[model samples]
Target: MTPRTGGRKLCGADELVFYDITASFEERTIFTDILKKTAERVFIPLTVGGGINTLDDFARVLACGADITEDSADKRSLAGIFLSYQAPVEVPGVPLYSYLRTITQKRPELKMTARKFRARVGEIAEQLDMDSSFITRELNVGFSGGEKKKIEMLQLLLLQPKLAILDETDSGLDVDALSVVSRGIEAYRASCDGALLIITHNTRILERLSVDHTHVMVRGRLVAEGPGSLIDDIDAHGFEQFEVAAQAAGA
Candidate 1:
């Protein structure tokens, strides 16, 4: 048994453990074997998440004795949740306009015709200072850092999700691109009045936006939390203090 497994054996039945098998999704045989092993050995309540995409997945996990199962991918679309990945995936064969249209039409409440949707997207693209022909190209294929972020922002505006989870949206962006993205985020919050869950190492992106809460996490543990002023503190002092505190507490 692994050292981690040995450690888990010392825990009481009330203790909770989490396992992520997102990478094992493609190899179901291995994934199921792991579930069976974890289920048979662990005595505590288990919350298994990741890589579960369907009803079959849910059934398989529960049948294997996993107490609870959750998958963000399963609920993201139906719940009107948008997540901007740190590195957005590229769709080589799909045109941007076509992809946007497909997702927009899927939401019946939007009640936008194809023509109107096209116009709306164009308007947003223009606002981002993008070329009119930009959306005609394949989605995220052969795009620069700025172009990719612009497309992500376009999706954010077009879909107008109830919650926008932006993961390091400012990564690799130059000053100009960063400025544009900050404006897009500002516009989204102002117009959509949507809840935002932004995860970023850089405080520059948060400058233009209104931050309600700031949380400092180190080594997967939340060490500090406060209001918007926390951002300014972090900007000036950096994360060294929080990291030191986390280390001191054996986080």
Candidate 2:
């Protein structure tokens, strides 16, 4: 029932009409034509883009209209849905790596040029500093958190997915190990025209990364977002401001 600009009339609609508006009074009223037009509309909840690359950009977009965002607990509903191939969701209750032995058997395409395939996988594995011997072993078998993450990156290199959503990829890694993980990630970024989404609270791994945007989600809602600089700021100041913003938005 919300119509923004260029509407001649409003037909008699349903009951309980109300909308949320997220904007400063100045921006809402400064533009004479837009303000007049808004006064004529039925929406109050401004859809301000909670994701931003800079504070000025945030202000700019808010001036326009935006108010929505996302992240985890989202693992199942969000990540699970987007991931259709070779994900843990494919075989419930089975360790992801356990399927590796039989996976190639399931798909003939993976078996073609098997020798080249193993070598290719070895190169990527070494990029992660993962031992070549571990290839035949089960996944996540006595692997450290960082090791597991690296293996995940190995899968990414092998599959070359068009889009990858890595939740908490840097959860457990020391400074040195993180560099290996980052390198693997960078390699995958370089090898394909795919998109990568790395979700984590840590900032060290991002130091040498070329991040397009970083979004901060508080209580499952995105409160702020910006460029790579945002990561450093968050590492230093944390998400206090974003938490407050999310709360205010909900209220």
Top of the candidates by TM-score: 1
In Å, residue 185's CA in model 2 sits off its true spot by 1.0
lDDT per model, in order? 0.78, 0.58
Residue 201, model 2: lDDT of 74
Q: Candidate 2's residue-wise lDDT over 1-251, tens digit each?
A: 45535433345433222133244666651333443354456444333223333334433433343322222333222221123222222224445444553443333334546577667777887778887766655556666666666666777776665467777667657787788878977997899776778877777778878999888887776677778778878878877878877778889
Model 2: lowest-lDDT 10 consecutive positions: 75-84
**What is the C-alpha lDDT profile of model 1 across 1-251, one tens digit per residue?**
22236425664456445456656456553276677787777756566656666645655665566655243563445445688977788899999988988888766666597789888998888878888788889999999988899999998988887778999999999999998899889889888957889999899998888899999898788899999999999998999999999898894
RMSD of each: 9.5, 13.5
Clashes of 1: 0
